[model samples]
Target chain A: MRPGRRIAGWVFIAPALIVIGVFFLLPVLLAVGLSLTDFDIYALASLRNLQFVGLDNYLAVLRMGLFWRALGNTLYFVVVGVPLSIGAALGAALLVHSRLARCRGFFRVALFTPVVTNLIAVAVIWKYLFQTRYGIVNFVLGRFGVHPVDWLGDPHMAMPTIILFALWKNFGYAMIIVLAGLQAIPDELYEAARLDGASAWRQLRHITLPLLGPTLMTVGLLTMVGYFQLFAEPYVMTEGGPLQSTLSVLYLMYNQGFDWWNLGLASAIAFVLFVFTLAATGLLVRAGRRKGWV
Target chain B: MNRARAAAWTVNGLLAVLALVTLFPLLWMLSVSLMPQGSASTFPPPLLPAHPTLANYRTLFVAADLGRYLLNSLIVSGGITLGALVCNLLAGYAFAKLRFAGRDRVFGLLLAALVIPSQVAMMPLFLLVRELHIVDSYAGVILPALASIFGIYLVRQYARAIPDEMLEAARIDGAGELRIFLRVVLPLLKPIILTLTILTFLTAWNDFMWPLIVLTGNHHFTLPIALASLAREHNPDVEMLMAGSVVTVVPVLLLFLLLQRYYIQGLLLGSVKR
Candidate 1:
């Protein structure tokens, strides 16, 4: 309560408060205002051209087919990608956490390498690996008598390919978290189960799953939130191409806001994405609570 | 016992295969970068180069001008790391140690704001930068990074563990708050500061969307932005693109390899506490 301490507190926190206030928080508030106006390149040239359109931008974005298509693409990504990643993470965690497993350190690093690698760079590598004719993915598939599927070049396949790439890159991160959760489970539970003649599968199904509920919920929510903002992968890999199947909501916002400079429409798309994110997160939390995991 | 041994073999075998699958793309990237020009586009898709060379790397630097982008990335990321460290440390320490009104309320606001994805503010943030005439400049890319809610939270969590009595001892010895922070608290927070530095650097270096939006010309491009633009121009040149990937990924990959403990700890500390 001393004046000196209070003043020091204010001084220490001022720089961060100012920067975040002016850049992050202020922009968020301004975005809502910007969304309600017809702000475009013309407005950029002259502020007098900026017109207050109220909720028209939001209505226009709602009616726009591209916006809906982008939303669908994003939803398709989250719906499929979240489960694929969690499954892979759970499997990898179980494997690495297995008593029979060896070289735990090596395996962990190798798996996690992808998560830390440059997105645009790895995306480029993936583009090559899935490059139809000369691509290694198709080349390997041919050995199995499976024909070369156009991974990124086909509309239906593009989103799936992106999903595959995402799962591969991201699962390790979740796996590491799950592995931590796995380790936290006391050894006596397994020992007790073993003495009772319960199988490893039974132990995992009953004990591991029940205990890992909270961790899995958190992982699932984080993965869903992250996947909803898919941008860089498709930006570098497909450019939302092959009939725009890989175009995400964030990608749409990027194109509208940056590429086209339609700040109003772009802000509306951003908010729409925000709403979906909130709704999905809320649903997950509710589901978690209903299951008594939270 | 035989069945148990067999199960162990199966688990290890699957793990080996999984590790291989995970690392195959990155390994192939290194190999293709060494392959002779146009060799990676072969029928079997050669795993390694017949006559290994640095020609692709040479072309990346000399012909593609990746060196400039690399320097730009270093400057921008370094600037951000240093600036963010100072700001976050001061604020985080203040939130943890100093007495102030509305401190908890403001911190709670920041925690809530974390749910608002950064992309939601990108449109107006970009416009704001333009109004400030920072667009197409490195300042635009580096300035926003000076304020990070997550960074502040991370530092605060670590700072709270610095026993208050140590700070009190320093204060009683006629050391001012700023002096105590620099002379007394900083030494205790070295590990965390390093972790923050690495995280901020990696995030800034690998950052794509913001840089791509802000940096218009090739002159100001970071590695990721430069590589993305280069991919568009040289999509068919598989070997060349791999070389670009290597150039873009190698620095961060090396950094992670060197500081794996700090990086992973930062990740776990940030996530598990949630």
Candidate 2:
């Protein structure tokens, strides 16, 4: 590249860089700063009430039982949701990858269709499907002598319902990624395993999982991170639920930020979520390194 | 011919059942949408409607103001696609081919920024929008989305594959950078641009979270927001909600079905490790 051309390159990129830096980076810094303060609706009208309380907002979030409830709900989503989603994805991929599978392309598309469908649209469908009285789900359950359950209205079932919808919508993504991983695995490994009299289960445990380590880590971490940002499902399906059972931290943050206009407190909540996500991501990476997975 | 073969078929057959279960809700949503107003709530739960009608769609267009929401979605999604393409293309080109001070460092910083959830910035961003007095306006919903980090990353990877010798030759011919970019680089990069265009539009169109929070009014509400609100208010109107679901979901479904290859390829590209 010529010297004059280099200047043009910088010029081409400068506007976007400036826009991102000012609008995105600056606000994030301000949010971190604001999280340390007690900026509320009062502070919104006037800056006089905006006094820096030095971790007071964070402490308040810690003390709030709602935050704990939201955290527990989010963790429940992560721990259970991630595994089930990954398992479903893996199961689907295995089927698609199998030699016995015919019309593989059609099944792949059918399974993946849900991944790209509008979340709000499908969550609405799930909400209605899980409706307590006259719902298809309960109606089906009644055939087996099980009574109708208030899925979204019951504290026990609300989060689980959200998790199920999430799995249905999301697992296809992991399936595609894992299918790619499965394809990348050398056929020779499986052939060698078969020659050694290895069963399918043993081959999967020793050869498939071991060889799929890096992709598995990436899949796990990505799934965990994605699941933690749980908002639209609960917001649409349960509205954070009958007992706030489906309320993830991000949903609570949005309710606080937009509904109550507690910008400072919401920013604190967002930072706490960021901290939790970062810690989880960091732990995954550490574990990956320790196990030589990456 | 053998028990093992039958067992394998059984496993696949069970998976086929599971696949149908997964897709049943979406198909049922459409089925209900086509049903008459109260036909959706029945005891036997008809697989296909007894008497299908376009009345629900007519209702969506006339009574529910979904026509306006559809227009808004198209405009917002179109504007985002146009703006994101230019910004991502230029910046991605710069990242891939350009030389400037702190180029690697700036790129590294951007990569690091990707890890921080956008929600961390959401609170401060809302405040900034409020201060600008642009909250609830179209600009609030569109501006921040115009330049996505992921879009840039996608374009950078695509642009990096362009032959550097061609750009050098164009520069030697006394063509300006912008002209060369427009005439030379862009034509060569057409396929990826199309892919990114579809992706950015679909993402912005189907986006729920930020738009839901920022655009609160009925007028400003996008398709997803309008559908979500309708779901809340008219829960009993299963036909109406299903109609709304079809309205929100059908366009993207068509787009995906038509361009499944690009969409799927782009999906794998943006996410999975090569």
TM-score of each: 0.98, 0.96
Question: Best candidate per DockQ, number?
Answer: 1
lDDT of 1 by residue, B1-274 (tens): 6998999999999999999989999999999999879888888878889999999889889988979988999999999999999999999999998878889999999888888999878888988998999999999999999979998999899999988899888888888889999998889889888889889899999988889989988789998998888787744577888888898899999998998888877887778544
Q: Report how far residue A145 has shifted in candidate 1, in Å.
A: 0.9
* Predicted candidate 2 versus true structure: per-residue lDDT over A1-294, tens digit per residue: 557766886788886787688678888888889898888889888999889989988999999999999999999999899989989988888888888887788889889988888999999999878878757898899999998899888899888888898999999988988898899999999999999999989999998888778777888888999999999998888788878898999999998988888888999999898899889889888999987887
Best by lDDT: 1
Candidate 1 positional error at A195, Å? 1.2
lDDT of 2 by residue, B1-274 (tens): 9978996797679678867977899889988899998876777666688888989999899988999999989988988889888898899888988778878888888888888788888878877888888888788888888787787788888889888899888878989888988999889878788789889888998898888878867888889989888887744588888989988888998898888887777877877532
Query: Would candidate 1 be rated incorrect, acceptable, medium or high by CAPRI criteria?
Result: high
Q: Positional deviation of A187 in candidate 2, in angstroms?
A: 1.6
Evaluated on chain B only, what are the TM-scores of all the candidate structures, in order? 0.97, 0.94
